[model samples]
Target: MAKTSWHELPRGVRDAVQRELGGVAGVEMISEGLSSDVTFVAETGLGRLFVKGARLDDDLKARQLRREISINPYVTHLSPEIRLQVEEAEWLIVGFDYVEGRRADYSPLSPDIPLVLDLLGELSETPCPEIPLRDAGRLRESHARPEDLHRFSGDALAHTDLNPGNFRITSDGRAYLVDWARYSRGAPWIDATAFAMCLMTCGHTPYDAEGIMAALPVWKTLEPGDLDAVAYYQSAMRSAWQPRLDPWTNASVAAARRWFDYRVGLEVGL
Candidate 1:
């Protein structure tokens, strides 16, 4: 989606942002994330802050924004600190302490792999905050068979989207996961499996990705045939996304199928 420029905002909304930031010296629009209509890094008199917003009337984006705000406190240690949020002229905008980091590399031998896995290990054990979060099964219902949904059942707070773009690696070797709009309550292993899918996309084989994750406690708790069920669920999701033809969807479908095929081979003792 094309990003909305800082100048494109209504004067009142811009004023609200400026007031919240004390004063803005410069603004750089960010185009990576899809949920926000306006995403930018503003150089304010106080400091640079990453900000994003959408029209209040867009129910989907509005809800996603709200979810991010609500989840921020709970996941602060794993994400940038939220510093500003204001609603004006029908637009709701939010700001966060600008993070100094690069997009995470999920390649087979990237040192980032360990940092990301360690972050996921912490996330798997982090208790779910008392907030309304969709159940993992329900979130995947349209793309997965009902019988297999049971495999995703649990109370662990899962970051459903594990795309490399959602991870940031700092110069000091710290890793952070961003975009909590789709976080769900699910089996602790869900995020690890999602990470494995991303690893495969970056050239790791199914066995290698799963083997690396095996060091996490979540992986050790998987019941027999659990991974096969996850594979089936993921393959079904790929089929559902096939018609989209978007680059992300296409790449994800291809990666998902590789793991799915490997699981099928395991089932047949190939």
Candidate 2:
């Protein structure tokens, strides 16, 4: 889908949002969106809000909307606060508390790296709520060697998609994860594991990523061979699809493969 601008939103959407927000003074299209929706920030009489909407007929997009709605409350402080959800025959929309900032720089030289790691540390401390989240293992269950799938299940709540664009760093120097579309129940290290790969995609070496993730409780306790299979299957799944979706997928591909190789070496007693 082509990028959606604020001006392109349906009048009903604009009206419903304005009614909820008291009144809308301005609408600015935020171009940093990754999903197929019209995402924008509206300056309202009450306050500024981030709003995302898509056609109700788009099944996948609609499910993603519901997923965000279902999971955001469970992962408080990790995602933007959702103010209201507007559902109608033609559209489904939700508005969030507008957060001011840019995406975190995962590159080696960037100071934002530590801030993201710090945020993850804090997030790791948030216990899982009772909501039923998708199992993380399901993503690669078919491709995974059987034993790897068992390692992926757990009680910890994870914001499974930790890609750079999915999180932003505030001007005050804090990291906030934005997309909660893939919220899942899984082993805690999987979050750190996925993030380590994200770091590698941004030019950090696998070893450098390891240093950042080394202190997490799950990472500290996981057995080497189990970690290997999980990392290998996870990365391999990403390598299969990400290349077709984004131009920079190779960096992620390399990073995930490198981690997989390291774990494989450990398994073989090398």
Candidate 3:
């Protein structure tokens, strides 16, 4: 769906929310987002907050909300507070305490790289009963090729979409991950490889031997045939990239394909 403006909310829905939470003094439309409707800042008597609204009728929107709530607590170590949910007339509105931060252009390569890796590593380390293993398998199945499907049918949870834009870096230099809709359990190394590949695709040199080696140490320990699966998944992901969507997305996908092909040959003699 195309991006929506704050004024696009149904009059009844907007009125109902105002009645319940008291009149909103201001509402500003944010960027042109792909998944959900985003508002810059919504002012209330209580405080200023970021508002994200989705059509209640859309099943995908509803599921994304539930996913956000489910994973928010588990990832508190990463960022800003997850606000309460406000359901108003056919709309699911979620308010998050806006964290002041900027999106980093490239994945922090030195200290921050390992920090992000460790944070992601910890998520895969512990088992969460709330996150069903089946969901992970389903996601991998949807994204992986038939030949490589078996490798991703594991019991580990992974943040399937780990990119710079999805992360926020606070003034104090803390990284907070946003966008939980794509979080699911699956092959652990896939997340790390996805992150690295994404970085490389965004004009960062994460494909170098040193960078690959850094991730390989962690990736190799996660599962059998992990490296092979990572390369395969990277290629698959790049193959699906649509240049018409966005330039960055297009470049990343193209770079990931080449990087994976080169890495596969160097590593497995394939």
Candidate whose TM-score is highest: 1
**Model 1 TM-score relative to the real fold:** 0.95
Each candidate's lDDT (Cα)? 0.87, 0.77, 0.66
After superposing candidate 2 on the true structure, give the runs of residues whose Cα lies further than 4 Å from its correct spot. 268-270
**TM-score-superior candidate, 1 or 3:** 1
Clashing pairs in 3: 157-185
Tell me how far the alpha carbon of residue 182 in candidate 3 is from the true structure, in angstroms, after superposition. Answer: 0.9
After TM-score superposition, the amount by which residue 42's alpha carbon in candidate 2 deviates from its true location, in angstroms, is 0.7
Q: What tens digits encode model 3's per-residue C-alpha lDDT throughout 1-270?
A: 565666777887677666655677998678744667645567865467666778878888777877777777777666456655767767787767776776655543444555566566666565654654345545656456676676765666667777777776666767767777777666655566667776676566534633644654456655555555666666676677565767776777777677767766777666
Model 1 per-residue lDDT tens digits across residues 1-270? 677799999999988888878999999888877899899999986598999998899999989999999999999888888899999999999998888899999887899999998998889878998998889877778777677888788889988888888888899999988888888898889898888888887888899989998988888878898888888888887867636756667777888898899999988999
C-alpha RMSD for every candidate: 1.5, 2.0, 3.3
Clashes of each: 0, 0, 1
Candidate closer to the true structure by TM-score (higher is better), 2 or 3:
2
Q: Model 3, which residues run further than 4 Å from truth?
A: 15-23, 107-115, 125-129, 132-134, 142-147, 209-217, 267-270
